[model samples]
Target: MARFNRKGTTKVLFVETIADPGYMPTATELGTAIDYSKALAATDGWSIENQEIETPDLASTFVAKIPGDDSAADSSLTFYEDDVDDDIETNLAKGTEGFLIWCRKGRTAGSKGMDVYPIRVASNSAQVSLDNEAAKILVKCSIIDRPLQNATVPTGP
Candidate 1:
């Protein structure tokens, strides 16, 4: 197996239209690529919970467990604040906007190390300090569906 590192990783986000659930923004549709890798510090939060319930049977000492509904994927992204336009601040300000995020984790082409997530930005906040420290933004988002793993990058318009 080949080991991958984050040195050459890249991340892009595409705004999705509200009317069409199947609408995926293409490169031509997007006009310009919005790369957030520079400001993005971390991509954390992807979880699935299977709620198990124990059977209430008295005959058996061992209880039988049944799986319940799976919980939605909730994710958080941290970004290092910057002054440039189209940066984290601008993106986060687009509250409740649906977005598709592509995260590529390999340096070379043909590398099959990518993850695509469909998400809606739920909330965002930034902190400032008097000390000589850079500002940071924390964005909380909820996944629309299960993420596509090792998927090809979306084609351009």
Candidate 2:
């Protein structure tokens, strides 16, 4: 078995206006990807939730249950305050802009391991203090829909 590490993982955030009311943008549609890893402290964080529901039934001791709603995915990307730019700050502040979070591991032709998440910024906040060694900005977002696994790598302009 082989083990994987975060050494070669590349994370990018593509900010764009939502063209359709409920659609996620594809990689090709996004231009000039922002190399978020430049300011990122570590690999982009991600999570998923499958809400549960229970049904009442008198005949059985255990209640009937079923999965509720689509699985919701959320993530947070923390950036070093010094490395972030004004453009990113302004975009994030807009709150209504849509973003495509792209991750790829290894750059070789056959080593394409990619994942893309379409998301909307849920919150934008920062941590600053005289006592802390470095200031940091944390952008939290919720997935607009299912992620595009093994997505075609987006090209740059």
Candidate 2 lDDT score relative to the true structure:
0.61
Residue 80 lDDT, candidate 1, scale 0-100: 81
The residue-by-residue lDDT of candidate 1 on 1-157, one tens digit each, is: 9665664566555555423344434445434546666677776775556778888698888889999777655688878877665456665664666555565653233445445556777778876668886777888887777655664444533
lDDT of 1 at 44: 75
lDDT of 1 at 9: 63
Q: Model 2 — TM-score against the truth?
A: 0.68
Give residue 56's lDDT in candidate 1 (0 to 100).
69
Pairs of residues at least 3 apart in sequence or in different chains that clash in candidate 2: none
Poorest 10 consecutive residues by lDDT, candidate 2: 18-27
Model 1 spans with C-alpha error above 4 angstroms: 10-12, 17-32, 84-86, 106-114, 129-132, 154-157
For residues 63-129, what per-residue lDDT tens digits would candidate 2 score against the true structure? Answer: 8889886675557777677663565466666364565555566432334555566677887777676
